[model samples]
Target chain A: MESVRKKRRKARVDETLCVACGCCVKVCPLGAIAVVNGLYARVDTARCVGCGKCAKECPASVIEVQEVEV
Target chain B: MKKTNQKHWYDYLWIASLLYLILGFFNILFAWLGILCFFIPLIISIVRGNKAYCNRYCGRGQLFSLIGGRFGLSRKRDVPRWMKSKAFRYGFLIFFFAMFFQMLWVTGLVFAGAADLRQVVTLLWTFKLPWHWAYHGTLIAPWMAQFAFGFYSVMLTSTVLGLITMILFKPRSWCVYCPMGTMTQLICKARHAGEKNSDKSDFVTEK
Candidate 1:
């Protein structure tokens, strides 16, 4: 049987909150973002790795975190 | 007025020198001291926040950030809420404990006598791991133990831990659970929660 693990904490970016500095884009290990209008970044959601690198890197602290058990 | 991320690109002066000399003294220096230096900046980063270490002090991480920026691969931080599971907790537990183990093992050796000493020495010259033989090379001899298998183990574990956090939380989660980050964090605990002039993490917020 294959092992399946569910994601517990959702990583989020408030577009209004995000400065679009591109730190998140540069820091994310997995390719989960597409820059919109050459300004803000949006996560593909499916590919995100929840490293929290984005959270830490976020200047706005707009990335609110909610931890759940999967 | 300099651009927000622009200053980050120009600061690489000691990037080479620091890692270069410090890596050489890995095993030669007292183990805890070596650990201390590796983490001082990291700790500074932690208490200081990820921006400090990720942007200012860390040589390797900076290079990655720079390249990622060029690729335009930089993305906003976002994910679903359900992803936060106990698995992240467990992974963090293991990652944190492992770091604790290293500090304890070293401290224990000093307090408990040769038993702890033997492990470090064994770690140094076990001549057991498949990669051990690499230490034999002229280029490899200087960094044989710590830089080779031991370093690999630490980096691999960190990388694995990092991967886990990235997959579930965000990239660079290791900075959060990172032992090195913890140390720096511990050191910088005294600052007000607001702006730290000494902090590079301030860049993300410094308007």
Candidate 2:
């Protein structure tokens, strides 16, 4: 039987408060975070390593990281 | 307009770094100093802000822009889609760390008398680079040489990665996948969080 991988944490952006300053986009190592349409930050869960860089760098404190089952 | 064209302090640091890289070939200690460029900037970014090191002192990135722009090597081509993918960058980071830890582990083995230093040095071709001459055939312990080898490996790897991407895509394209840049960004974020928390406490006290 194949072993199951543990759930991984991913960063999520609350679009409502995001100023879209692109700070998170500038800092994400994997390019997992991007500013869409110059409006708000978005995280591509598939690309996010749950490293928490985006959440920490978000000046608005609008990003959060949570564990999810894949 | 002349003031705007004035050379920044970081421009000098970049030139110093280039000189250090050449001098490091004679003394591994100089090489170690050269490599400190990464750590020093990372520390500044954490304590000051993300832009501290990146905007002010990253000589390599500046050089990339300078040369890439002049020679038209800095193409506007979109970075290869795969290069931007998480799998590639994360995999590279993981692989880099694995090699790093492996070198450290071997250093431990040498200390334990379980491994020959020369044999260990031969494990990676990178270990024998001529730039490591300062540590060779001297009183310096084999492990020191090994440590320097490992450190230089990481530095050279990052430099090459940046160079390739700078030539193939935009001058700053390597920033997209740089592990050190990511680490500094993480540090910068933590600093911001702390500042925010303090501001919140101050607000509570004032009210």
Candidate 3:
């Protein structure tokens, strides 16, 4: 038997660059992102499918999607 | 590649917010224009089934971003956890509506000849400040003027609150708990849910 490897995509936010504008929160289709304490946008890896909607809508361009091994 | 700093036509809406404040300063009656800010977001949310107005067209948010981000007025700190909580946001919305209804009640009293119009703008829902200088006895009814005064007070108070929070936290932090933003978000979610249900029904019919 062989073990299987799975890769998934998730959105990441750069807290240093985020302006906490809530644009990503409004555009997130899965409601996977929220502005945490009005500080930065935090993405829930479980809910985010790396759809890139938040990254596209972010005014600060601080969000990026990357593939991760699961 | 999308340029993060690129300016769009909607980016200039900050000017409109400034112009509105200035106009209301000289003549409080001009505050009626605030209704556009109140209704346009709801209308766009209902019609487009999105938060496009809040995302792209909110003048107040733009103004906050300009002053706090561009001008470096904000401390760029994190807002308190309580301010960002759902309980606080919904409570603030309910309180805001209660104050709005009280404003309408006062206006109704004036309209029904049960009370006299007071040329005062209450700040922070207390501390009545005389606003007689702004009025020149226009042809508009007294009740209308009363409503304008009350409405302008609400708008000004909210702006002041936004400015204070902007100075204390990150730019556009006010959007996190803005009553209008909350309302529009709810409307957008409701619309999306309805669309999903309709799509499921269509799929079943096809099957």
Candidate 4:
């Protein structure tokens, strides 16, 4: 028996779950996460460092991070 | 702690675009290399569509788009407002007209064999033109004024042209209008059409 799941986009930050905090923005080493729309900042997944600052500083703890599979 | 920094192979393309532009086009210094940049990617794009150099590569395009995306100038699948942006519309008008006149003048000179280094320098210079007197004569006109204006025109042209072509038609205008894309598709077509003809005989024999 096997299960199939749709592959989600890697390292995407959900805008809805975002609490408009700058922690992830600050913590990113790559300068990837930018506060767009003035409130809910956006993270460019392609540029994410995956250091987990976003996951940690996210007061809502909603910054979901992913790694590229080798 | 052992340091681990991971990066992608494609990053090289960005650097390549920069070096190519710097050593090639900026001076018109390397005629051969500039020819490679102008013609090769154009050939590639025509054959492959957006992937050749426009979408995935082409350092200039990548950088321009990155800057625009940074500033929220990127367009998505959604229909973007047309001419509704007076700034954009007028900006593009000014840009295209300027480019057109400049190119026309250059072409005329080239035909007349009067083109010189002075002309090239003037064309590339920020303060050398008439508009500079009006707009860039302010307190902030000296240093990055050129860069800002260049970016402004480049981004606006690329975006507006893309918007007009893409939103107005399907599969976008890269198929036809883009010089680089058009040239590439021409090459690809010539090659693929030959392959298709070859494949037809094989198919009939198999059947």
Candidate 5:
């Protein structure tokens, strides 16, 4: 029997580069991103479908979509 | 996770907001510069199809973040539900535009010699506070000065309101219902809809 693994695309934020401007928060259809503590943008990976809207909308260009094994 | 506390050039824009207020305080003419604040966001939204100006370049927002977040002035409470509601946000945007149009109308009247220049700043759209001291007669037309005063009043009033909200709630709470933010959001939505329609048309043509 061979073990099978599943992979999915998810959006991730570079905490260092994020400006916490809330642009991602507005553009996210799933409402998975938020400006935390008025400091940086935090993306909730579970709800994020890797749509790339937030990545495109981010002014700082800190967000990226990556394939992850689930 | 290590968070980098790096500062970007745009982060320093709060100084511009402070300088604007200071310059306006010394000379009412400087208030005319507020036009940049009025047009820049809309232009960015139309040209770039995003809210980059509100997110990255808003000096007033940076100022509030500095005061309310860095200085610990904000209670950090979430803004009231009503304030976050679409009805309230749109209502505020409409009310803001009404006030803006009224100011422009007054400026037009002054330009046409239909009304005298009023050297007073109306605070919160109600109380008219005398701002004559800031106005020193210059070589420019009185109507120009009139527009400056009116525009400055709008800018100053909004700034005061933002500071109040910043202190009482989250640092960037004012951004939630900011007229410029609302306008840019609408523009972005319109652009998004237009793009979607075009995509649909392309798909249909291909089929």
Candidate 6:
């Protein structure tokens, strides 16, 4: 039997749907989210502490926090 | 056309918050009530999307704007670019958390019998402030004292920021750098990242 460890969850954005509205950018306490190329929202996972503040502010309902198995 | 700003009813909430702080001198629990005001909204914003608490119910923000508008207390200057920078905001957040957790650690030590309650309370600058008149000669448990000290520490931090920003720039300028605002933003970011793509209408249901 193999045991799988669950890594910490992080917030990620669905780029295709992100309108680059910058709501998440303004709301992120850690400054982990930014609008890239003036088109979509991007998340800096390395900098993101997974506080989930931005997800609540996304008007498009495109951002989500996900769990990863490390 | 130049836009004129309008004041809303909730802006008076700051006055109410101020009253609450004043009342702390009579009954210290009012200070704890102030903590609950921030804590409840913070929890709601984290569990739900968007910072509804800040948008709908921040008494401090309202008070800042109210006094700024009525008394011309604000400098009417823009918040300096650097103060709004991510580095400054996040750096302050980190510092706040460090101090908060340090206090909690001290509380833990007190509970574990390794520290004295009186000494630990002194670690909080506001402990000896004029407001504690209500606290003396009262039968408060050690844990309650520790909690009160923690609340005082938090309030002192906000008051310092509020005073500096309210004086140097526009009123409510502290919102840009508030640690609680930053924490709420982090929670919103994480929630947005974790949720599945859906229509905006689902926003209400998602919560």
DockQ, per-model, please?
0.04, 0.03, 0.13, 0.03, 0.10, 0.03
**Candidates arranged by TM-score, highest first:** 3, 5, 6, 2, 1, 4
DockQ of 4: 0.03
TM-score of each: 0.42, 0.60, 0.75, 0.34, 0.74, 0.62
Candidate 3 structure quality by residue, lDDT tens digits, B22-82: 8887898898999999989888778865556666678999898788877999887767767
Per residue, candidate 4 scores C-alpha lDDT tens digits across B1-207 of 212233435434656645643442232323234345455565553544222343234454434333333443433232234422334434544665476456445545544556432222232223342323223244542223333333333333444455454434321221223344333433444544534322121111000
For model 5, name the residue pairs that clash. none
Task: Please state the i-RMS of candidate 3.
Answer: 11.6
| Maximum-DockQ candidate | 3
Which segments of model 2 are wrong by more than 4 Å?
Answer: A1-70, B1-4, B85-91, B118-136, B193-207
Worst 10 residues of 5 chain A by lDDT: A32-41
Q: How large is the i-RMS for each model, in angstroms?
A: 11.4, 13.5, 11.6, 21.1, 13.1, 12.3
lDDT per residue (tens digit) for residues B33-112 in model 6: 76667686578656665565555467776666566645778775656667766688789889888877877787687678
Question: Of models 2 and 5, which has the larger TM-score?
Answer: 5
Clashing pairs in 3: none
RMSD of each: 13.2, 13.8, 7.8, 15.5, 9.0, 14.2
What is chain B's TM-score across the candidates, in the order shown?
Answer: 0.46, 0.74, 0.90, 0.39, 0.90, 0.78
How many backbone collisions does model 6 have?
28
Candidate 5 lDDT by residue in tens digits, B75-162: 7665676786668878999999999999999999999999999989888988898888888986889889999988889998999999
Residue A67, candidate 5: C-alpha displacement in angstroms:
20
For candidate 4, give the lDDT: 0.40
**What's the residue-level lDDT of B133 in candidate 6?**
56
Better of 4 and 6 by lDDT: 6
